[model samples]
Target: MEFETKYITPDIKLALFEGKLFKTEVMFEHHMLVWFISGETKIIQADATHIFGAGDIFLIPRNQLATIINYPRDGKPHKTVAMHLTKERLKEFYTRHTAVGKLQPLQKVYRFSKHPLLESCLASLIPYFDLGDDLPPDLAAIKIEEAISILRSIDKAMDGLLADFEEPGKIDLTDFMERHYMFNMTLDRFGYLTGRSLATFRRDFKKTFNTTPQKWLTEKRLELAHYQIAEKKRKPTDVYFEVGFENLSHFSYAFKSHFGYPPNALFKDRD
Candidate 1:
């Protein structure tokens, strides 16, 4: 199964996938906090069965083996907004963040909140669906940012529900990375912003996702590059630079290995 990343901002990502459910295995380099807007399915993970319905929220940590059965039929669609985040992303809001850090190996699933405040905030995100067109990048950015704010608010509220509260503010890692992924980002800097130690960040990150920070960052860049080549009609040369891949040969090799085809082949017309 293939999952595409869309509308990535500082702290969130809006992803969409329309595909038949078959027995499958999935993994993520970053944490996935999913709002299942529509669809009914049963997810089997770690020998446990989870029945999910519309309006239910599910959290899947970085690396896990799970199978989703799209009930009713395979042709039926399952739509969801998966907010891909990292512990480092949330730590930016406070000089002394502790909620996620305290709960090492946090709970992987939380039922939808009955709290009216959270319910209403989640409801507001539905309107952003109208702004999905690729045109109007400015308007799209504004709407997407608004949606991210709402998600952050919900995350705070949910964290409270779990009784793990932290500072109140938006953690805008998306803006930071847009400006700074080119520079060498150190664990010390990242930990200082999130109130974690470099050692703690590395340990928790590896425990939660089963991958190192460097590997995840590389995969994210490649994912962005793949999106540009296939969806944005971007040239390989332009995409390499745009995604901060300085070496074209490395980019091409990685692209071919990951996608099983040359970059140009992704844009070629098929019979």
Candidate 2:
């Protein structure tokens, strides 16, 4: 990572980086609140894509699977202030505060752009970023609490997302796997996220899909990559990581092994 961070704490950071465009896929364990200072980001989830630029403020909820692509805009670096809202902190806060709802809503992300209270809360932290360890321990907690309060007070939609503190329940195995196959997570991690043990996930997956998890994942990823290359005219370099393979070489080899030809061959045939 090529960036300079002015940290008030490990959880809150100023993401300052220049020159390079980068992409990453992740499943966040904590909700992330961000205020962009410059550049742009395109965040892709299972069903939607969002483009945000400087002065944009947004919250990505915990356990959301996303692919984030960051770019420098108009000669400036991709810079932002980000704070992680951890479950432990939220749990403590909600113990005293009255929660709005017990059921979770289906909203993908929350945008609180330029809201006065949120702006004030986030901007107040910039000065402390320079202080480093010299900053008091309780300050981070205070600011986080302030941010949470602002979120809950302003957005009617915030309650169900921020207040609910339950682990994921078991969903339709086939549907969950289909939607999330492109993410590269270990079997245990995948199982845990779907409210299953490693053994049960395997057992249920076999019953539902009639194939092992590894085999099913590889085939689904390759098929998606093939569609991108052959049907969508995308390059192998561009298609590899988005389709879940870690590297172009591995994706190419797998593409050849599975399809009886390399990905580039499909591109050439299409062209």
CA lDDT scores, all candidates in order: 0.54, 0.86
- For model 1, residues 1-271, the per-residue Cα lDDT tens digits are 4454445343344444566442333444455656665656676543356887666766665533344555333344566665554545434433333333233334355555333543454455555544556335454344433433554465664333232333222234444334334323455554444445678767766775578867766677778788887788788876665454556898888878877987878767733
lDDT of 2: 0.86
Please provide, for model 2 over 32-146, each residue's C-alpha lDDT reduced to its tens digit, 9 standing for 90 to 100: 9999889999887777879988888999998888888899998989999999999999989988988876658454978887787888888888888878668888999999999
The clash count of every prediction, one per candidate, is 1, 0
Residue 5: error of model 2 in Å?
2.9
Best by lDDT: 2
lDDT, candidate 1, equals 0.54
- Can you tell me which runs of candidate 2 are displaced by over 4 Å? 105-107, 269-271
